[model samples]
Target: MNDDLRRAVRQVLPGVRTDLDALVRIPSVSAAPGSVEQVRRSAEMTARLFKDAGAPDVEILDDIEDGLPAVLARYPAPPGQPTVLLYAHHDVQPAGSPGQWSSPPFEPTERDGRLYGRGAADDKAGIAAHLAALRAYSGRPPVGVTVLVEGEEEIGSPNLGTFLARHKDKLDADVIVLADADNLTTGTPCLTTALRGMAACVVELRALEGGVHSGSYGGGVPDALTALCRLLATLHDEQGNVAVEGLATAVPPGAPVSEAGFRAEAGLLEGVQLLGSGSIAERIWAKPAATVLGIDAPPVATASPTLTPVARAKVGLRVAPGDDALKARKALAGHLRHHTPWGLQVTVVEAEVAQPFVIDARGPAFDAARRAYGEAYGNDVVDIGSGGSIPFVAEFADAYPQAAILIASAGADADSRAHGADESLNLADFERACLAETLLLAELTRSG
Candidate 1:
């Protein structure tokens, strides 16, 4: 039965790619102003596709004020069968700097056996995978299915909790397959068991009331930029581990990813040394990390020989699994305050906070997913951790504590370049993902 389903998915690959192409061409960037209509168009298109795929009930969910649209559809379960919720996002990130892309960001160009576009791999392919799985079943699978494609995942899913709260009964299911993550590597099926939480803030240091001529007050006066730089430097030590106190760092149980593999995956320049201690996977996947996203400083081209009065920097922190993001944010802010140079006045404004997630992958649904992924890829499925934060994952876990949550992806790995230049999806991985989902649904309906 699974073999037949795989063949069926293979036969529908062309149509799936066509639908993905249509989705990739929409330019539905959720972060851009005035792009709400484009987001709505994408959501409507997604609804139409779900309806075409045999979903008896499909609706556009736009309950949040000024929120981008989402699509919801349900295929009722056969008697005594379980329902699975398929989650993906229809909106995409902005196509930045067209000059950096090999082809137009929204053109959906095919080259070197890969599809290139803004949303080609990040998530549009995920929606296409769900569609392909439904098509493989001829729109009526052994198990029930629900599709919930959101429109604002890229912008932190501010309205997702509200939507989920309002429609809890409609979206409840026995299993959930979140296809917004990545495989460990191409052709290697990986189940993401943990994701780090995130916290961010803007730290401002004010030393003087106005800019002063550096030539006149060179050594006597305090420079806010220098003070800010010093405070930021205290975040990391010489070995580059996060130097902040009161943050959690507990490594999850998993096979360590090798240094060579991480180096290749990270695309490090030659002779660049890796930072932090412990295994590469532990440092990245299970520990806190802080990064200075940007600073409010004058460009070198427009520099003036003056001591700036104030300087501000946006600091982003990734909390380890099992850690409290709010606590981490407070710790970071306190660190900045304590390390302020020359008694400079400092202000830290907290921005966003999202808790980390860790799933217990030891139930029937996970067993089914493991078998299905192994069958699809002809390899053993490995458990892994993602450093990136998906706030909605935690929300889903809180809302449906009993439901099995599976974190799988069709496009991950170094070559996918998701959210980067030359973003593309490997056709083989995409096909395997479709087959995996189809087989998972089939497995759910079988006798234990």
Candidate 2:
């Protein structure tokens, strides 16, 4: 059966490649203001793939009041077999600019061994991997299968929890596979065992009543933008560590990553020292980190020499695995306000926050998955951590405590450049991912 599955996956690769290209052509940028239609088209495309794969029930679930579309397809389990839930997302981050990419962002192009386009790695290829695995079995697996491809993951899945509650029966399973996240590197099969949660806020500082000429008000009176910059600088200490109090921080459980490899992977310039302390894995995976997402200051092209009266910035903080996201967000706000320079008027409007999670990947289902991926990749599988947050992961854990959740690095690798310009997927790794999932389903059946 394993050989047959391998042959089947090899045979379906061409079709899968074509489908992936076509799917990548759609600009399903969920974060854009006018992207509803594109997101719907992507969801519809995902639904058609599952329907064609012989799913008994395929639905585009858009019933959530303020939610975008999602594809849910199910095939009932055999009498004694446990069900397996497969997950991915059809939506993607916005492609920044046409100039930032070599080829057109919407046109999927193959160069060397990768396919480049928006959503090619972050999640759209995740959808393709699921489709390929389903097709490899001719749409008839050893156990029951359920596929969930959501439309708003890039936007933090605001409505996912409510939708899951309303449609719990359709999604419940014994083993859940989250086919998102990145591997340790290209050609290395890994399962994400820990993910740092995230919190965000928009902070505004007000000083003078109106803008004044820089020369007229140069020396004595401070500008709002300068004060805002000073406040933002206090988030990190001299050594580049997050100085915010009351946030959880700890070293993660993983093998230490080499400094040279880390520098190359992160694309750091020569002689640029890394910030913070400990191994790269520990700093990124377990410790808290903060970033200024965006500022509402005047652009260089439209700038005038004047003291701006008001300045605002959107701040983002990554919560450690064991920390509470809301608490960390509050602490971040507190630090910003406490360190405000010159007693400037400040307002911290809180934004979305998601709790972190750590997976105990030692059960039978996880064992089976690890073995299957090892066999498929010809390398032993390893445990890794992700700095990015997937809000729905916590929601899934709360909804189904007994299920064994598997977070697979199905499409992304170290150099995929996900959520950035010219994002791409390693083609060879993608094929291995399909084979790994195909083996995983059969392995789950035996374990069950």
Candidate 3:
């Protein structure tokens, strides 16, 4: 059966590539104000693929408040079989600047064994993997199937909770596969067992009423930009670890990421020192990290010889596993306010917060996934942690407490460059993911 499944997926690889390319060309960036129609189109295209794959009741659901449309499809299980839900996002991040990309962001380009484009690896490949799995079974897997392709993940899935609440009964499943995360590396299948939470805010500082001439006021007048920079600098200590008080940090389990692997994966330049203390995994997956996303200051090219009056910065904070996101947000806000320079007036507005996720990988579903992944990739599956946050994972855990949730991925390495320019998918990894999922379904059927 495994050989037959492998052969079936190999036969359909061309069609899968074509579908992925077509989906990638839609420019379905949900965060852009003018891309709603494109998101809808992408959702429609996803529904068409599922419908064509013999899925019954495939529909494009647009009832998610101000959110982009979502595609949902269902294929009932044969008698005594368990139902499985497949989750992936159809929306993608906006292509920041065309010049940063080697090829156009919307046009799918194949080069050096990768298919490059926005959403190529982040999630469109995930959807294609699901389709491939179904195709391997001739659109009728041994176990029941439900595909939920969301369209607002990039923007933090603002409407997912409401959508899930409204459609709880229809979404009931015994197991779920969230294909939005990455594996440890290429060719080594991994199950992500932990994910950090997130907290973010916009902090504004005011030092003067208006800009003043640098020549006239440079000596005595306080500059908001300078104060803001000072405040942001306090977020980290000399060792590059988060210096914020009241935030929790943990020691991650399992093998730590080596320095060489970290440098290679992060694309760090020579002579550049890594930040923080402890093992690489601890610094990334088990500790809080703060980043100043953007500052509302004059650009270098447009700067004038003036003293800035006000400056605002967008700050993102990653919360370690087992930490409360709301508590972390409050701690971050307090830190920003207390660290203000020159006693300048400061305002911290909370933007968003999402709790961390930790899954218990002790069940039949996980056992099946492990064996399937090992067989598909020809390597022992490893347990890993993701520094990124997926808010919906906690939500799904709360909503379906009895269901087994698994974090798997088609894009399993740093080279995927998800959410960045020249985002690409490794075709070989994607094919292996499809085979793994197919085998998992077959294993579940036998176990059930």
Candidate 4:
């Protein structure tokens, strides 16, 4: 059956490739204003693919309030078989600057076997892989398939949890497959079981009320920019760990990262020793990491030569699992407010808080996925965790607690440059993922 499924998927690769190209050509960036038309078009394309793959109810479900469209597709299960819900996003992050791309960001260009575009790696390819797997099995897939391709994931999936809560029964499934992730590295089949929580805060520091002449008040007046620099500097101690008080930390249970592997994949230069680590996995996945994202000050090239009155910075706190994002933000904010030098006033506005995700992997669905991946990749499988937080993961967990969740990402590599320029996914990896999904469905139906 696995071999037959593989052959079928191989046969369907050309169609998958064409569909992926067409989807990528649509500028489906949901976060940008005036991008609704493109997002709707992408959702329509996904629905068409679902219909082509034999989904019974492949409809573009649009939110009247949000105006974003989601593809809700369903295929009936044979008697005594269970339903599987496949979740992925049709929306993608904004393609920042065209100058940064090797080719036009919207144009799907294949170079050296890699397909490159804004949404190619992040999610659209995952959707294509799901379509390919479903097409291979003529959409029956040995188990019922209900797919929810969201259009607002890049903007934090604000409506997903609400939608899930409202339509719980409609989305009931025995297993849920989330394809927004990738492997631990090339050639490894990884199941991500944990995700670090995230907290975002914008810290604004003020001093001396307003800007003054640099030469006249340089030494006398307190410069807001200097105060901000000092405050941001204190976010991390000398060893480069977040110094915020009351931030909860935990050690995630999983495979530890090797030094050689980290060094090679992270591209760490010489003389730059990686900071604050027991293990790379611990530092990234379990421990808290703080970053000062953006500071609202003049550019170095456009210096005003004045003592700035206000300096604002956006700070990001990557918290470990089970850590409360709201608590972390409060703690960091309190620390900043109290630690401001010389009575400088500091205001920290809460930007966003996303709770972490941890999936229990001891279940029949996971066992089936392990078997499917092993068969597809011809390798042993490893369970891993991520430091990045997906805001909707916890919501999915809550909405589908009975459903076994599986994370089979195509670019789950440590060096997979997601959210960065030059991000690419291997075509072979994509094919393997599709075959694995097909096998997983077969295994799940057999389990019943």
Indicate the residue-level lDDT of 425 in model 1.
89
How far residue 263's Cα lies from its native spot in candidate 2, in Å, is 2.1
Backbone clashes in candidate 1 total 0
**Which one wins by TM-score: 3 or 4?**
3
What is candidate 3's TM-score against the reference?
0.98
Off by over 4 Å in 4: 267-270
Deviating ranges (above 4 Å) for candidate 1: none
Q: Over the stretch 281-358, how does candidate 1's per-residue lDDT look in tens digits? A: 889899999999999987799999999899999999999999999999999989988989999989999988899988
Tell me the RMSD of model 3 versus the true structure. Answer: 1.2
Per-model C-alpha lDDT, please?
A: 0.90, 0.90, 0.90, 0.82
| Clashes (N, CA, C under 3 Å) per candidate | 0, 0, 0, 7
**Model 2, residue 141: what's the lDDT?**
80
Weakest 10 consecutive residues of candidate 3 by summed lDDT: 249-258
In the range 1-448, model 3's lDDT, one tens digit per residue, is 7899889989887898899999999999988999989998999999999999889889888876676899999999899999999999999999999999999999999898888999999899889989998998889989999999999889888887898898898889999998887877789898888899999989999999899999999989889999999999999999898999999987675856878988987889999999998889998889999999999998999999999999999999999998999999999999999999998999999998899988888889999999998999999888888899998799888899999999988864668888888898887888889889888999888766
* Residue 146 in candidate 1, Cα distance off native in Å: 1.0
Q: For model 3, what is the alpha-carbon lDDT of residue 425?
A: 87
Q: Which pairs of residues have clashing backbones in candidate 4?
A: 181-409, 182-409, 182-410, 182-411, 182-412, 183-412, 183-413
